[model samples]
Target: MLIENMKMAFSAIRINKMRSFLTMLGIIIGIGSVISIVSIGDTMRTMFADLYKEVGLTQAYISIGYWLDDVRQSDYFTLDDLERVKEVFGDEIAYIDSQSYVSADALYGRAKVKFDFQGIDYNYQDVQPVNIIYGRYLNEGDVKGRRKNVVMDVKSALQLFGVENAVGRTFRTTIYGSTDEYTVVGVYKKDLSPFQAMMMGQSDGGSAFIPYTLLTWPNDYFYAMRVYAKDDVNLDDFFGRLKVFIGRLKMRDAEDYYMATAVEEMGMMDSMMGGLSAAVGGIAAISLLVGGIGIMNIMLVSVTERTREIGIRKSLGARTKDIMIQFLTESALLSACGGMIGILLGSGLVSAVGAVLGVTAVVRPSVVLLAVGFSALVGIFFGMYPASKAAKKDPIEALRYE
Candidate 1:
């Protein structure tokens, strides 16, 4: 009986192919928009997760700055402070390294570029390891010997020397007021997160890393310290101890300095992304309501046009419930077909956009199912009035109508 009802519903639709397509238009646009936004949001979330994973979430950062009356005071971390952190954490700490930045201008023959300079200890790579495409990274010998060796990011190397493989090449740069020459010993791949890019000023800016020992500035001062904890250590316990130790050393409140773990940062980002996705999806859903109304209006017109047909069916001993079911099935099939088309359209659009943005578009199976189910519900809700109207028509009255 159900199959027979579907066939009759489909036959009606086939008879008015153009009108049926026009009615389904609204559903197609509504579902397509929502699905496309969802796909893009999921892709962005995945990208952020991958970035956090690449830079270990177990790591923490301590910036050397203090606040007084809501005003921030720039300060620096001393070598003594680093030693105290090590002594306090002991076995709980895996490794610690300090880094500072300076602004300098690099000159290689006629080509010159200005960039932010970074000074790092030998153990810096142990905490934040980057891929080395050419030559070797900084080692204990370079730090102990106070060697003026540097490692440049691939983009920076290309900008400075017109080639990514600029290993063993020397460049002159002015540090403070004195001019010094440094040899590029390695080229490292660059992968900066949005926060890191903003902090570093430019995403593709020319920058180089050198051993802190080579800098003439007081060895006691550093801009920030990165601390990595052992895998088995309890991070909460470690952070609590660190706060107390820093408080005693600074002779002030532990909140004076900014201390945070990568995990905390990632959580904040996740919440923000989730809210954005929900907001976008909600806005797009408004179109579905409009689509439902369109379906209801068209179903009413169909009933009015087929009044004689309904009367004949009733006269032939057809039940009122049967008439209602046929109409309802037609409505559902109309909406379900639109939903299928929208899914295909949305997925294709997402893939095209993802290719342009260099990201892999992600569409979950659950999202697809939800979209189809919601569309079917819309059909039922709107189709109710029209179906009831067709079922209640008196056979004698409908048959007498033109």
Candidate 2:
């Protein structure tokens, strides 16, 4: 009996195929937009997670300075401070590295490239490992010997020497207005993301790393200290201890110095992405309501057009429940068809967009099921009024009028 009702419902839809298709259009567009946004949101979350993993969430950065009206420059952290942090944290701390930067221009023959010069300790790689494609990274001997050796990222090497393999190549740069020559000991692969590249000042022209001892900056002041904690260490607890240590060392509050961890940074990005997805999804959901309204309007018109048919069926001993079921089936089929098409459209679009953005698009099975289920619910809710109206119609009056 249910199959027979569905057949009749399909027959009705087939009679006005164009109108039925137009009615399904709203649902198609609404479901497509919502699913696409959800897919993209999931991709962004995955991308951020991968980035955090690559950078190491166990790492933290500490910037030392004095703040009056604005931030005021002070002396850089000493090796003693690094030792003190290690002593305080003990086994919890894995490693500590410091880096400072200076603006310099590299000149190799006629090719000249301006870059942000970084002075880093040998342990810098332990905190933020760089892939050495062409030579070796800095070593303890290099720092102790105060060797005039430098490591350039691939981008910088190409800019300075017009080649990827730039090891042993000599480049002259003005350090605090004094001309100094340095040999490139290695060429490291450039950062993959724009954010990471910008953080290292590699996006603006290029950047190179040198031994901290070779830095001519005033009185050995460093820009920032990077601390890496053991895997078992809790970042929140570690940060609290660091804040206390900084306060005691500076003879002021811990808030005086800027301190941040990769975990905190990743958390912020997660929150931002989640909020964006919610806001976009909410906007897209509004279209579902509009689609529901369209379904209701079309169903009402269908009931009016089929009033004589409803009268005929009633006269032939058909119950009001039977009439309601038939119309409801039609409405559900229409919505379900739209939803299925929307899922295909949305998934295809997500894959295409993800390829362009270098993010892997993931459309969860649960999300697809939810979309289809919600569309069916919209059909039932909106179809109720029209179906009820048709079921309640007086057979004699409907036949007489039509």
lDDT of each: 0.81, 0.81
Q: What are the clash counts of all predictions, listed in order?
A: 0, 0
Candidate 2 similarity to native, TM-score? 0.89
- Candidate 1: which pairs clash? none
For model 2, how does the per-residue alpha-carbon lDDT over 28-76 read when each residue is reduced to its tens digit?
Answer: 8888888899998888788878778877889888875435455444535
lDDT (tens digit, per residue) of candidate 1 on 1-402? 999988988998899899988998888888888889898888877877777766676788886444455532224566667778888787888777675677787899998887677777677776678889999898878876868899988888989899999999999988766788989999999776554454336644587788865553444466677788887888878877787677678676677778888789888988998999889888778888888899999999999998998999999987989999989988888887788788888989999877766767878899899889888888878888999999999999989879
Q: Find the 10 residues in a row with the least total lDDT in model 1.
A: 65-74
TM-scores of the models, in the order given: 0.88, 0.89
